[model samples]
Target chain A: MENPVQPLEGTTSKKVFWSALASGFLTLGLLLVSFGVSGVAYAVPIAGVGDFYVEFDKLVGKGYTFYPKMGKTSSSDSAPQGTNIIETLTIDNLQLYKDFQVGGEWIRVKITASKPVQISGLQHDAGLIEANAKFENLVLEENNSSDWQKQFQQTSSTIVLENAKLKTHYLFQKTINMNGMKLTVERIKK
Target chain B: MWWKRKFMLICCSLALLVSSAGLFSQGIKAEERDTEGFIIEADRVVGSGMTASLVTRETSKNDGKPMLRFQYNSATIYGMKLTKQVHSDKGPVSITLKAKGPVTVYGMTVDASAISFKGACVKATETVPALGMENVVMVAHYMKSDDSVIDQLTLNTVFGSVGPKKPGQLKVLQDLAGLPLEQLKKEIARISAGHLPLTCEDGTASEDLSGPIGLIPNPLDEVIGGVTNPLDPILQPLDPVVGGLDPVLDPLKPVLDPVLDPLKPVLDPIKPVLDPVVGLLEPVTKPLGPVLKPLEPVLKPLEPVLEQLEPVVSETTEAVEKTVQTVCQQVQASGGVITKELGLVLIDEALAKKVPLNQVCPTNSSVTSIVVKLQESLLNTLGLGNLLGKLIPSDPMEQLRKMREEIAKKPDGTVIYKP
Candidate 1:
């Protein structure tokens, strides 16, 4: 048995406060957790805030806590208490198992050999959410309309992954290796 | 040598027992549970009370078929690559997943087609195992659901061939084929209504799908049950009124029928005289149909635009009226005259007067007024006093005396600088 790597100690492992598309994006979700014996330690030098994943090869969590937005529209209120995600996610291939509980439960994912992923750029922003809207083309007076335009402020995070790699193996199947993946994240400022 | 042989035998027995226990307890099999593609699952969690799951709730769009959602925080896919060969393809694919804790993916399957979903959304099937520790298998294959969807759209295309064809329909189909897995599940919900038993006992596949076709993009149907036809609601009360009139008409019909029977023979004889007139008009009215058909294409698109603009135009007219009223009031308050034909205001004549040497026009200082009078007297000796009077609106002395008698409200509240 090989020992799992431990990294990101003392630093805050980013907690998810997520939402997806105003339509379905506000409904979509993306969560990344790595675990092993004690607490799994894996190190990536790329520094950023918020959830931005390149490849999901090795999964070692005792169990996952998924709080999907129950409502139709993706709003800050759609996710109550701890799980409010207003975002849009683009996934390659995702699958889950019915059982494998260590106290709770989690699933092990193995990326296919031919379908190695390289997430060069990522934008995790839900589209505009407007309320009390005037006409789309109406040029509002400059005086009091400032408050309404505040909703258009761009507060979304962009993520770029550089030098990414994935190494996965199966007990009864062939192994898959992914290397030299580069990802870029750009911010759209208002 | 006998002791060493016994030890070897014990070692072999221990190894055999362990292997047998693993097989019986876990049911380890090669071809049973394998997923080829990317996977997310709740594998092993740190604490208790943590639950990993796949959520596939249908949304309102794409007939709720596009809302095939993988709501679990963790899941896995053992698709084709996990089997004898590796094949990785893009979407227009649907699948069902069984989630296991510590997230071991099992019993996942896929079916792919050639048509694109455009941006409509793809259809997918999702499954969850309520009981823990159940083993499942992943499978892969191609599907043929696009045939029905194409048939529906082709029917629409034939009917909508006239004007402003929505190419977006084909685009919607093509993009729906590639909609992300979560969005695809939404479409699947619209198609399958959730649970899809894709395979049958005899190894035949029959999928019952009903994609939303040519239905006017109606969000209001799902958006809180709005009034579909505005006029229908207002006119609904008239229906009861019309129905009640039948009883009144029924009693009158019995009495009136016998009285009108004698007129039938006379009315029938005139029909022969009207026949030639009708035939003569038929040839003239035949050309009107083609002439009127061309107007439909131009007016159809503008109908909705006009409806939307009607309220705006009315509101704009009211706003302009309010603005004119405000301006008229402001002008009146500022001591100006306004009427139906014209608006007029006049400045104080003192402002037009030239300053007398060192004193300014409208000056009140006694010292400056004396200096100005002295300058006037000197200029008057040179016959230039008349020129000064014409240049200025009035003498500074006369204007100062008249300022005290002006009307009402302290004269614009005496516009003072804050300083």
Candidate 2:
């Protein structure tokens, strides 16, 4: 019996040490979640200025906002703002989720794609329109690895308003990949 | 050692299970709920809303089977949606969508072919989408019911009328053909009832026809509509008027009646022969009188000349005929053969001497004798008395005779002939 078989003193200590190491690794992993963590923020200026003016500025800024002599913008917001600037936007790898404007009028948005795609829905006022629109000649682009990690593929979308009051909620969203894709959005007044 | 190994395997299995659980649960909520489907082939977005349908391109490999897609943003899905909510309705249904710019709607039914549509700007109500640039709008009403669009009225920007001009009205009216008069009246009445007047942004009234008219593309002809013909109005009432509308008189009838004027001679003294009513050829015959008169004076000298030359011509003709007859008789007499080589040599010698004289007749008997001898030699040499007979044997008579003889001598069983 070799001195009545002294209890194996080190078994519990070995088990405790291994358990502690496993817990430490788990904690480190929790602090550094890696896959699928996106730092993309999709936001449009909504409040500070009037709606159509914002659209007009966006059109002027984006270079797609043009006023037809016959078609008129909303009667409100009399500030004359016209620029020949061509609005060029590039989406690195992020998707366009919404079109928000703070004011009283319903505005129009124009979206051009480099490649053809099936648009999922035309949403306004939070799921107001149940139908969808398909567009041709949509511009799409891929993300460049040398760019910032948050850079995404780009895409474009657009819309316009007829009798809608400014500041109305006009939001749009789509699911897409951005390894390399792009789209452009422009506005025109009616 | 065995127990330790078993324990390690158990721990590994639990770790695998725990890690997989965390990985599998880490999907985006939006993507998880997204019901993406077959790619949208084409769509028309009207106003600000999107109307997309599954499209099989003119070059798609889908074999006529339509695949549905969503029309969202600027992209459409190809047929794989997590879930779908189909909205179907009966009766009059109208859907209003907000669209950004000019857009089109494309769709197909379960048992129907795909069709595309554009929004018709309701006169003062809606505006037409422009070209080149993009526009925006909220609330494009898509009326999908058969009777929902009873009548549509649009403003005539070009003509500035309540509606389009005569040709335009004719176009719209032509579509009403085959419908009963009562039906036309009923349709018109219905249109008038539902007619919505249009106004410009400045609030100017365009025309009175604004209210009772629903302007639509002429189903028969694509033209704007309106009319002015009185008789045409009875057939297709583009415009209606009161009873005094009887034409003051047929427009074609002149205001002054020649019948009532006595100053007009009972009959003109003489009607001019130059009247166009007679014929346009009157001037053509005018030159004939002078032309025929000059022909007499000119032909008089020609008659004398012709008479003087007649005897000479007759004598010359007689001489020529006699020479031709002599030559023919001589040729026939020489065994119907003339020595062409001797004739050619003589002609060549005569021509070399610059004599206009040619062999109109054979001058030497030796030439005729030579021709006859040559003919005899040729006939003998070619084995030909009759030329046609010598050239074409009559079915090989000699061979026929020999063959008949051979047939007579054949052994009884020598030939196995098939019929």
Q: Pick the candidate with the highest TM-score.
A: 2
TM-score of each: 0.17, 0.19
- Give lDDT tens digits, candidate 2, residues B1-419: 99999999999999999998777776443223311111111132222222223222111111222221223222111221111111112111111122333333222111111221222322211322221111111111011111111011110111011111111111222333345656755644443354332111122332332332223333334322333334464864534444335475454255456454644554453355446646767777887878888788888889989998989899987975675555546444545343433333323333434332123234556444543454344334434435554532233333223333333454543321211
Off by over 4 Å in 2: A1-190, B1-115, B119-255, B258-267, B271-301, B307-327, B333-419
Worst-scoring 10-residue span by lDDT in model 1 chain B: B148-157
Q: Rate the local accuracy (lDDT) of all candidates.
A: 0.29, 0.30
Each candidate's DockQ:
0.02, 0.01
Interface RMSD of each: 22.2, 19.0
Residue-level lDDT for A18 in candidate 2 = 94
Quote the positional error of residue B45 for candidate 2 in Å. 18
Candidate 2 lDDT, tens digit per residue, A13-72? 888899999999987675334312432212322223222211111110122221101111
Q: Worst ten-residue run, lDDT, model 2 chain A?
A: A52-61
DockQ of 1: 0.02
